[model samples]
Target: CPALGDVFCIAQCYRAEKSRTRRHLAEYTHVDAECPFISYDDLLDRIEDLIVDVVDRVLKHREAHLLDEVNPTFKQPKKPFKRMNYSDGVEWLKAHGIKNEETGKFYEFGEDIPELPGRKLSDKSSKLVILMLPPIISPTPGINTSTLMIREVIFDRCEKKERILPIR
Candidate 1:
C-alpha cells in the first residue's frame, strides 16, 4: 500500500448542470475512494467484494423485510458482473435494433451512449463493466485501467430508474 493507503470520503457534491430526471441530481451525497498501489484487477475485486458485503448486510438488517415488500424478486446479483467493452456494447445495441431515434446509424466509438436500458438481459441481473475506454473520449489518455463503468437501469412501478454507483 502507498503512504496514503486506501482513503474514502463521504462528501457533499453538487452538480451545477440542470436536470429534470431523478437520476441526475443538483446536489447529492458523494462517496469517493482512492486506492493507490493496487492493480486494476485488485480494484475491481475490491468493488465487487464491497458490493456483496453491503448487500449481505442490508439483507440481514432489521428493515430488510421492507425490501421484500418493495420487490420480492430482489436477490443478490451474481458475482463477477458481466464485462463489456465499449465497441462490443455498441454492437449489442445495434443487433438489438436499438439506436438513436434521430440518426439511423449505429453509434460509433468514442460517442457517449445517451441512454441504453435495453442492455439488461431479461432473465439475468448483470451490470456493464467497460474495461477499455476509447482513446478519443477518455480524459486520461494512454491510461486504460483507470476507469470502471457499471451502469444499469431498474424499473420501479413502471418508472425507469438508473442504478449506478459513481466509481472511477
Candidate 2:
C-alpha cells in the first residue's frame, strides 16, 4: 500500500459573507487537518480527543489565569461530549418550538439551523455539543484527496462558536 499521511494547516482566511454576526467574520484563522483514510467514527473520536486535550493543556498552562479572566464562566467540558445527529437536532429544535428564520416555519430535517436557534439549542443541550451529519457531503477542496466530507462541530457554550459549515 502507498504511504498515506495526514495533512494540516493553520492559515489566515476570509469569508465572502454579506451578513455580519458575532460568529461571521470577514477574516479569521483557519486550522484544519485532512485525514483521508480515517473512518467516520474515528474522525469523531479524534475531534473529541483533540478538544479535550487542548482544553486540558490550556487550563494547565501558566497563562490559564488569562482564560479565567476572559471567560470567567468557562469550565472544562465533560468527556464524551453530547452527540446529536442532524435529524435529532432538528427534532430538538421542533420540540423546543424554534422556528426557521428565513422560512418562518418549524425547523425540519435538512434545514440549516439559524444562529440564534442553534445557540439556544446548544445552550440547552450542554457545554460541548458534537453535532454531526450536516446537510452537505462533497469532496473536500484544497486537500490532496477527493474523499467525501462530513461535518462534526463542537460548540463551546461560553463564547460565540464558529460553524465550519461548508466543505467545498
Q: If scored against the real structure, what TM-score would every candidate get?
A: 0.65, 0.70
Candidate 2 wrong stretches, greater than 4 Å: 101-103, 137-168
For candidate 2, write residues 1-117 as lDDT tens digits: 125588778899888878566667899987687776787668777877877787899899999999867778776776676767766778888888889878889987656676687
After superposition on all C-alphas, the RMSD of every candidate to the true structure, in Å, is 9.2, 7.6
The global C-alpha lDDT for each of the candidates, from Candidate 1 onward, is: 0.53, 0.64
For candidate 1, write residues 50-138 as lDDT tens digits: 77788899989999999889778675754676555455556766777666655877766545555343334222234534333222333
Best by lDDT: 2
Clashing pairs in 2: none
Native-referenced Cα lDDT, model 1: 0.53
- Lowest summed-lDDT stretch of 10 residues in model 2? 159-168
Clashing pairs in 1: none
